[model samples]
Target: MSAFVAEPTTALEIESIGNGTGLWLPPEVRDEVERVQSGTSAAELTAGVVELRNLIGGSADLFHAAMLALMCGTMVEHGAEPGAAIDATLDLLVATLNTLAEDPDEMARAASRLSIPAAMTMLARSKETRKRWRARPEIMDRLEALEDADLAPFWLREVFTLHDDAPLLVLDPNNRRAFEFRLIGVRDRLYHCYALLQDALLRHTGPGYLGAEPVDPLAVRYARNDHLTPADYRAATTLGDHQRFAFAYPGIAFMPGSGTPAELPTVDGVPLLTVSPKTIHFNWRPANMYGVIHEALGSSIDLIRELSPADAEALLSRCALP
Candidate 1:
C-alpha cells in the first residue's frame, strides 16, 4: 500500500465586527435636538433641557460642552456676562476634538453617540478653535516638514513602524519641554506593548502560530527518532527534505527491502530543507513562494468546505507541493 501522510489543516475563524464610524452620528440624539429647536415656548425650552440631559448623559466630554453652550446662551438672554462661560466651553470643545483626532478608536466611540449633522457641527466648531490656536503663529516647522516615513532615529523608526496605531504628540517647544520628554518616554514603552500584543496573538492562535521562540539549534537533533537506520533513509532525506521540515521533522523514507529507515539529518547539515511543504517554488532568479504563511494559516476551513469540487481541485493543483 502507498504511504499516505495527512497534512495538518488549520481552521482560522476571523470575526470582524463593524467598528467603522463612517462619518455619522446616531439618530436618537438628532431627533431629540430637532424637536427641542422647533418649539419657542418656555415649556419647549424645558423639554429641550430634558432632551439634552438625556442625550449627553453617558458622554462627559460631549455633554459638558453642549450643556455649557446652552447655559451660556441662556445667561446671555438673561443679561449675564456669558463671555467667560462661552470661552470655557469653547476650550472644552477644542480639547475634546483634539482627543478624538488623536485617537481613531475614541472617535469611533464618540461617533456612535452623535448624529451626522451634530458631528459636522462639532467638526465645524473645532475647525474654528484650531484656527484660534494657529493664529498664535507658534508652529512646529521642523515637524511639519518631516515626512511621516522620515520621522526617526533607526530604533525609534522601528518602534513607531511596529506600533503604528499608538498616539503621537508633536509638542510645541514653548510648552514644558520636560513634560514633553516624559511623553516621549511613554512612546518608547509602545515597542514593548507591540511585542506583547504579537505574543498574545500568537498564543491565542496556538503554539508555532506566531511569536513562539525560534527553535534552539543545540537542542535539535539530526534524526527525529532512533528507528531511523544509518544509510537507508539518508539518501531519500536530502537537503531539500531537511529545509522543508526545519520547523518539524519530515517523516523518514524507507528503503525498498530494508523494511527499516535511517536517521534524518539535522537542519544544519541540510539548510535547504528548511523550506515548508506549503511553499510553491518558482523558477525566478529570486524564487518566490506563492502564498504567505499568514495567508495559509488564516484561511477559513469553512470556505474550503463550501468550495465546489472543481474549484477545490483547482486550488489544490495551484498550491501543490513541489
Candidate 2:
C-alpha cells in the first residue's frame, strides 16, 4: 500500500490514472511562474506564493507540496540542469519532511545548529558594533551558553531593540544601524534564504560557471568572530568594491558600497525580491546570487570555483540543506 492520496483535481493537478508517490501541485503556482518569467509582472509571483501558503494551512504534506512546486517551477525557468536540480531539491525536502514527521523537534534542533555560526557572524561583522556587543556581558553570556544549548532563533530580539519577527525585512526609519538590524530578522526569513540559495546554486553558479582555477569549498565558513576588527570594517568598502560581491548572513544579505573607508555604505543584495530588505534609500533584488551560493555551501565561491568537476561534486555533497 502507498501513502499517496489524491484530492479533487484543481487547476494545478494533472489527470493521473493511478497513484503516484510524489508531490502534488496547485495550478496557480505554475501560472504565476510563467506569468512572472514572461514579464507579465513580478508581483504575480507573490500571489502564487501566497496561494501556496494558503494551501499549506498547517499540514506538512501541503507545505512540501508548495515547496516542491515552487522549487521545480522556478528551476524550470532558470536552471541550467532543471531535472538534476529538481531531483536534488525534492530529495532534500522529502528527507526534511520525513524528519519533521518523525520528530517535530528536529526543525528547532536544526535551527539551533545554525544559530551559533549565524550569531557569531553578526556579532563579528563590524568593529564598533562588536565592541558594543562585547561590553554587554549578559549578551556574551547568552552566546556562551549557546554552546551547550540549541540556539533559540528568537533570542536575538532580546539584545537588539530593533529585531522583530516580521517575515519581510523592514528598515528602521530612525536607526542608523538599520542594515545590521535587518540581519536579525531570521524568524521568517531563514527558510526563504535556503530556497533562494538552492535556486542560485543550481542555476547561477554551479558547475556551468566553473572557472580555470578550481576553488576549495572548505574555505567557506562562518566569518570568524574575533577576526574582523575596526581596520577590517574601515577597509571593507575597498574589499567589497574590488570584488563586487555581497555577503549573506542568517537573515540578511548585503552588498559592499564604494565610498570612504571609515563609512561603509551598503546596498540590498538578496536575490529574492519578496524578502529583500528595504532601507530608506533603496530596495534590492537579485543582482548577484553568488554570495548566497557561498553562504549556503558554507564555502566561498572562489574556493568552490577552483574545484575540478569531480571535486566540486564531492564538495557539494558535503553541503547540509538542513
- TM-score for each of the candidates: 0.20, 0.22
lDDT of 2 by residue, 255-322 (tens): 33221111222223322211122232321222121122112112111112223445434322332111
| lDDT, model 1, position 271 | 12
Runs of candidate 2 with Cα error greater than 4 angstroms are 1-39, 58-322
Tens digits of per-residue lDDT, candidate 1, 157-190, equal 1111121212211111111110000111111222
RMSD of each: 28.0, 21.0
How far out, in Å, is residue 321 in model 2? 46
Worst 10 residues of 1 by lDDT: 295-304
lDDT of all predictions: 0.26, 0.29
